[model samples]
Target: MEASFTKVKGGALVLKGEKKKKHKKTKKRDRSGERDGEGGKKLKKNLEHEDMNKHGGWWQTTNLAHIVGPVALQFYNGAYMKALDNGKFVLGAPHDEGQGPEPEEILMAMKVGDGKFSLKSGFDKYLRLDKAARMVGVSDAVGAMEMFDPVWEDGKMAVLGPNGRFMSVDDEDFVVFDQDKVGPAQIIRIRSNREREDMKKTEIPEELRGNLYQVETKFVKKFQKFQDHKLRLNPNGVAELVEAKRGGNLHETLLDRREKMKSDRMCK
Candidate 1:
């Protein structure tokens, strides 16, 4: 090995032939990629949850008079009514808390008459009261035995079968219409996947549900006393209508706008 020379503080020469120690450079890990991946996964999960809630979440029906759609019946035992493959109906446990019922557990309720509904299963079979007094899913078409009347009282609901008996769940988890009166076993919660109807939307006329300008024009044509049918609109923008809509006073604001134009018949 070649000897190298080093000068000390006192001008003394020292042999420095040792090889230079090489150090391995450690590269820092890119945590931003992992963080982005995790954030993307969380966003996707949240979007999936919101989409599921849009069409699959359960909501208790406050009015039994209008129970006509896809629904699930939950018994007092925390089980949902389900249709079996063997032409029978049973109460099955939910998979998780706040989870909606499965496809087999969903029933299509058709309003047959006042307070009467016909429940059809996912198998396209109508639920009927068999001769054995058991609720079965074997009928293809709705008949007298398929008609059910839902009764709501004190925020509770009960199903009355064609035989004038209340539907109840047995110890074996089977559903039957053998009870004469509504009891704990007979009480059920009718849940639907449909969104609740907004009372405000109901109060607004169907034709007046467009933009503010369109609503104002329609109102002028409907309530204007002038025979010329000319629309007299306020020169000021519809900013007040937008605010009124958010405050649930859109109708009053529209009337005020029409009164300012002197075109409303009821303004006087």
Candidate 2:
């Protein structure tokens, strides 16, 4: 018989030209409970998978402090550090300019210390500094050579490899950590899935929702009742309300203040 090869679903090559014997069909077993349990497990697995991929887009990190989680290091020329299937890294352009990095360019960054981190590539290899001072993604685990320190200065970020040198791209577009000082080539933008710091500042708490005096005034307007739609604020400073809030009696304090103003309908 002639032998042939066939490619399987998972990129595996298998030998063909074999005749297999069929087995006799037996009575089906009642495995409904087992099937339901397996279905539930698959649903849970799918939910977790969705959650992991939810935070996919990228935002630039202003400082080294925000360089954790899934990240991509882009050089000044708009090229991202992409890992190849051969366990090598190169500067590759993104499919979309501002959308985000491709899977091969995204790295899972884990903070190991105050300023140290370990980056894992899509190939399931940890990026490390080889003995030749070249950046490679061949390590299966995070070792000393896998630890990297991020440096932020003058609004630019640079990475320090395990060899205590700054990482820069060479003329061949290969990553090397041999530079003693940071320059245009060494200036990298570490982008991640984290929200921008300025955006986070826009989120205000419920109690502290508006301007200090405006919040109290709005409460007075809501509770105060008179023939005219007028707001009567106490001449007393907001120090009492601020203090009462710390003591968890802000509502009572506001009512008392409104009552003192003789404007609260409940006080009548």
Candidate 3:
């Protein structure tokens, strides 16, 4: 064996050692493409939550302020159709088994948002004198106005009728002593604008179903916070929409949701 002496230039060591251990690397997940199969379902769920919070749908956007304006307008639409066709909100929500917003009601809501007419902040609480002045902008004034109800009593303001009745400054609507009877009786008698009976496939589409549910859920939750606020407004919306309607009881009042869910396809 020949032994060779190594000559080092500039004191640098060069050595060949044992092999190094290979470490495993974890993979990074791409959530966007991951939402397929079971992953897809989870992605859908997350997306639904995001959309409901920011972009609420039409009927949902129809808050109390919006409803009163649209209601007043629908009354006009009904009166117009009634004149042109017979008398009632044109394209009224169908009467009978289906208890829900009608196409005409939807149309009226659209029309109101279309800039055809606008309301002041306190429009709902407007007295006969004020509402009368604003009546010119409304299409039909005939059945638009009426005097019905229980007067609202406040130390500052007092009204008397079934507390409140739909009325016009220059007109009068028939009064029903029993509140329970009138809603069902009249609600069932109206006609809807759309002939489409399948509410699930009718008003809202399937893809939007999840988002719609989110809107209602959030709104209801938010509305609950207004308990003390309700006692303040003319008739607290918090009271009527939230307090007045409770679990199970609220479900009983609305039409069979499962049945309705099967047909409604609308979402504005």
Candidate 4:
């Protein structure tokens, strides 16, 4: 995908894109702050305010094992999603850091129709999959990719993409890779190292051996081990995806970076 030139706003990279649709009003939330579904039935909010304060901010992994343990999301210069002109979004890292995510990284977690939410980026662009619906990107067009289902089963919260895959990352760059892209996929494992150490292998029930991990597949034995992360809401109410492991040499695959640079050159 072709990348669009970014404008530096307050010394931060701000992606330029089509304007976002102005919301007439925020979604109607019950007294408990729960949003209602299309039928007007109350649906659970992803992260309660209490949880947000305790955990930090949106889509951040606060699992005990991740916080002080070996596993942590790599936050090099702080990561944020950037959309390219060719219809692909890159999770750009090595960005300037101050307090939290930059204004451009703050995404609006709008309650679109149904119980799902659409992420509207600071560029006023909606995050959606490509025309083929395989790769994810931000666009002005409002399509299926913009709409994502919030799956909070097994004591975990995950955003189901348009391709029916959950947002996940592999050993590769911070760019999200669809777990279900190939076969049976694992969602997330939300257990701290201490919790895992406290549990007795035999004493723990087969079902609850770990804190909370999900596998969605039938007859597929092999699945990728994914760490569950929580999405936190900033004071401004914008949500940002956090990582499990922090500080990773700010690794950006040369191939991927080259492709993006090529796109940028073409854009000029």
Candidate 5:
């Protein structure tokens, strides 16, 4: 056996041994960008798209500031191939064989083209604003009437009508497609049933809070705090986008009357 000896700095006897090698630190790989089994497709990074795919199923809106709140875009009396009436589409959960939004009222809005949407109603009919832009009629044909241009502004969604105007509810609570001016009635809130259950009172903006005109007083306490959010759905009935916008001030009848009085006096 061969013996090895070493000397310390102080001249003290010390033994020499083999030096051990240092191993490099292993790095962790990021799997977020990894592709899934779905045809080697990578996951999307857009949060809105993800939210829309999660909660963008059946949606309804209640015009919190102007007309009725939670008014469903449903069919008339759950009939097939029937038109929608704003007066009949009041805010409430649909029941079996009752005056509420039925399966026919439940709609699936999908993006067919760039900024263009197509709506399928519960009645298995396509939604159309009619050639005259006066009614939300249904059509079996996929023509210009069935195509809608959805516009989002200030958190409110508006479906473009045939006349290039937005679909809005009138003061009479009737669904009308002849709103040239953008008002509270023109703002349609899109939300799912789960969203409505989870809706809180603080979601709505203070500026939009007050009282609902041409509606019951109970709705003020009932829906004032209920926040309306938009959900985007994927082709597989998943929500890919979810967002909330603070609606503007309420459209008050007193304010309109005051403005009318002022205009009348100014005419003198």
Candidate 6:
């Protein structure tokens, strides 16, 4: 498909056009501390509080192995899903230099369960630099330690973009890339003084006073692909028959495959 933009909001994203099928724009906020671990409004509310405190990034300075050993005991006791979500999030951190790992090369590993029969590191799987490369069209079989940095330990979180490019509005300079054309994209960092002042007009409800990370980083490559063909007169949206790169022969491709699948199954 063509390039499409994915908009990341507090907890989810809002996509455009065809791929925008089920994009979620905002999150339902909740208040009140959680007690009995459960789902629904109360749990959501408690998680919101924790989220505000956590702010998405939750890499701890303490030894991960030690934390995993003890926390497993109270898996359900006083456990909050919000913390778990933050704790379980995936991020790509580079390997520090000589002493630690190369900033952009090292892989971080975190265990999920607790001691005595708990799960191993959280992101041990995506450590395959080869696999990560394939996902982003890279050819070199670089080791996980050589290629892309995984933000969320490894497998804890799922995001809609490639590594290294995405950044939150809170970054030091907060440069945003606004796609000017298909082949070329423009970086729009530093808003004007008036725009900065106008930002006050964007009032969030009292409940959503915590996050803006998820909303900002949604513009990465993955989302960009979706944005390309996401409507608004790209002209590339024209339906046509094209040859498959993997197989031989050209076949007619339907634009809305979702509807086509539904119709084929006669689920109407």
> What are the Cα lDDT values of the candidates?
0.76, 0.74, 0.27, 0.40, 0.43, 0.25
Which lDDT tens digits does candidate 4 get at residues 1-268? 0011123346645469856555545454343244234334322333333333332332344332232221112223235444445545455454332233334434454566666656555556666765444334456766666776655433444446766765554454333535543222224322112233322355732432322121111101121222343221112110111121133211222223334434554697
Task: Give the higher-lDDT candidate: 1 or 2.
Answer: 1
Give the top-scoring candidate (TM-score): 1
The candidates, ranked best first by lDDT, are 1, 2, 5, 4, 3, 6
Candidate 3 regions with alpha-carbon error over 4 angstroms:
1-57, 61-63, 68-84, 89-103, 107-163, 166-268
* Worst ten in a row by lDDT for model 1: 1-10
lDDT of 5 by residue, 1-268 (tens): 0011122345645458856544453222224223243324333324333533443333344332211122244322222222344313222332443233345345565555545666665555666664445445356756666676656544446667646777665455445577666655455545444344433345754534443332222323433332353221112211111111123322343234335544554697
Ranking by TM-score: 1, 2, 5, 4, 3, 6
Q: Show where candidate 2 strays beyond 4 Å.
A: 1-57, 94-97, 196-198, 201-268
lDDT, model 6? 0.25
Which candidate, 2 or 3, has the higher lDDT?
Answer: 2
What TM-score would you give candidate 5 relative to the actual structure? 0.36
> Candidate 3, overall lDDT?
0.27
lDDT per residue, candidate 1, 74-193, as tens digits? 888667888889989998865665578888888998888666889988888888977778889888887788898877655567888889888898778789998876767778888777
TM-score of each model, in listed order: 0.56, 0.55, 0.19, 0.35, 0.36, 0.15
The reply for model 4, stretches above 4 Å from the true place, is 1-87, 92-98, 131-138, 170-177, 181-268
- Writing each residue's lDDT as its tens digit, candidate 2 over 1-268 gives 0011122346645469766544453223336667878999998656634533542456666655676778988888777898878877888864443356778888988888666889998888899877768789988887788998877654557788878788888777778898877777888888787665544556554654676488788787776677776767888888987898789887788878878788445466
lDDT of 6 by residue, 1-268 (tens): 1133333346556465535344353232222223233456666656534532342212222133333221211001111111111222122232222222112222233343221112222323222212222121122223433232212221121111233332221122121222222221211111011112212357754422332222112212122233245422222322222332124321222223323533454673
Quote the lDDT for 146 in model 1. Answer: 88
Model 6: residue 221 alpha-carbon error in angstroms? 64
| Top candidate (lDDT) | 1
Model 6, position 267, has a per-residue lDDT of: 70
